[model samples]
Target: MMTRLVTDRLMMRRAQSTDLEGFHAVVSDFEVVRMTSSWPWPADRAYTKTRCVPINAAHGMAGPVLCKGEIVGIMGALSMYDDGPELGYMFARAHWGQGFATEMARALLDHVWAQYDWDVIKASAYDDNPASVRVLDKLGFHEVEPTIGTCKARGGDFPLRCFQLPRPPLTRV
Candidate 1:
């Protein structure tokens, strides 16, 4: 499996059994989970270890983001029909505003661009998540359209702000 990445102030690596609880802490945070894309898992260890680890990935691989050694977030890509792959990320509340999300996004975008034939990398956020939109925009992604996608956290369709990028930005977050 693809593993660790080091950024300016972060160390992102593969998820581990030990990280389930910390990762779940981020999942339990309403603000973090609520502003994300698609299905959001409740804070459950069994689910996190059993169902989430094996399946919660962009392709067949994913790695969590750690700030100074704590599992503060995660990053990965989920491929779809003919649209290349979409990038996703979520960090814990205490870790916000620190550019960790942008740093991870920039790193993951670089990794994906190096290994895939993708013409684009897409991402989305709730319309109200300016921080998320700002992160994507800083990574050179632009608004495409909107979507009412499967949002397990909300238990139904939720509105999403879509953004797409042709390639990874040259800048490293």
Candidate 2:
């Protein structure tokens, strides 16, 4: 995670307090935050300033997703369960459906494969979020299970679809 991950249209670096405004914009929207695992919906600038940065930083995986040097969203991984690292990402509503999420996830996966010896990465999405499931599917993640979980942002339990991607074989020397 030392190097910034990049794609043709996005740049990802560790999230910092300086990105408060952009972070606020993305998480404040109900549509955007509803599907998220941790963010509390109806987020305001005050909450973003007070809470978001520290929470993201603590995860050590949350990074600002930038476009042309401007923050557009956040992407990263965290181990919520004892099994392994769980891949997660969130883009501003304005940037949705342009392949940015898939791009970011792929870049993250590449980085993980190259720099870490982990066997697999896990991810989960609300079963209702077809777009997220599509992104995971496109990256070769297969469904592992289904469970119910609470989304702090939405303040209710929802059906969660879990998926995993095993590390691809490394090249021979």
Candidate 3:
């Protein structure tokens, strides 16, 4: 089943073929792509299109972050590490400085924790991207370590800050 999450100002659902154009637009921006690890620098439409295809939820959740029916960003919690699913997100440069990243991430993390059986979710940010670091921090992700990570866009290894958020304690009625 496709996962859909709704927040006060954003709605995140499975990616559709129709979203390819918007997805490409966001990834095509060098300022946005440089902060991510997977997307290459010279954004390719073909690769961006491939990303629009939805994957099985058992692997993780991913989709477009829509605001009033327009794609503004992308968010995901993919099993990129052996430890657990990793949280990742990117927003259009126009949407930067807004609270969309934190809002979407909080909703995604909440949904993942409640719907999935994972004990913890992992996340990381390039040391240079203080914006992302702040987002992860605001969401209560604890810093675990500092390591070198490769940025496909930057085309080299850079200082990476790793983080993890454990599932919140259950509350009884």
Maximum-TM-score candidate: 3
Q: Candidate 3 — worst ten consecutive residues by lDDT sum?
A: 164-173
Error of 2 at 171 (Å): 7.2
**Which pairs in model 1 have colliding backbones?**
58-77
lDDT (Cα, tens digit) per residue for candidate 1, span 59-87: 63465787777788877765744766888
State the lDDT of candidate 2 residue by residue for 1-173, as single tens digits: 44688899998876667888888888878888888877887786776776345334333355788999877878777654577788888788888899998988888778766655677888899988999999999999999979997898879999999999888888111
Model 1 residue runs over 4 Å out of place are 38-42, 51-61, 80-83, 168-173
Q: 155, model 1: CA deviation in Å?
A: 2.3
**Tens-digit lDDT track of model 3 for 19-106:** 9999999998999999998898799999898998886777778999999998999999887557678999999999999899999998
Model 2, residue pairs in steric clash: none
Superpose all Cα atoms of candidate 3 onto the true structure and report the RMSD in Å to 1 decimal.
1.9
Every candidate's CA RMSD: 3.7, 3.0, 1.9
What TM-score goes with each of the models?
0.83, 0.87, 0.95
TM-score, candidate number 1:
0.83
Each prediction's Cα lDDT score?
0.73, 0.79, 0.90
- In model 3, which residue pairs have backbone atoms overlapping below 3 Å? none
| Poorly placed runs, candidate 2 (over 4 Å) | 44-60, 171-173
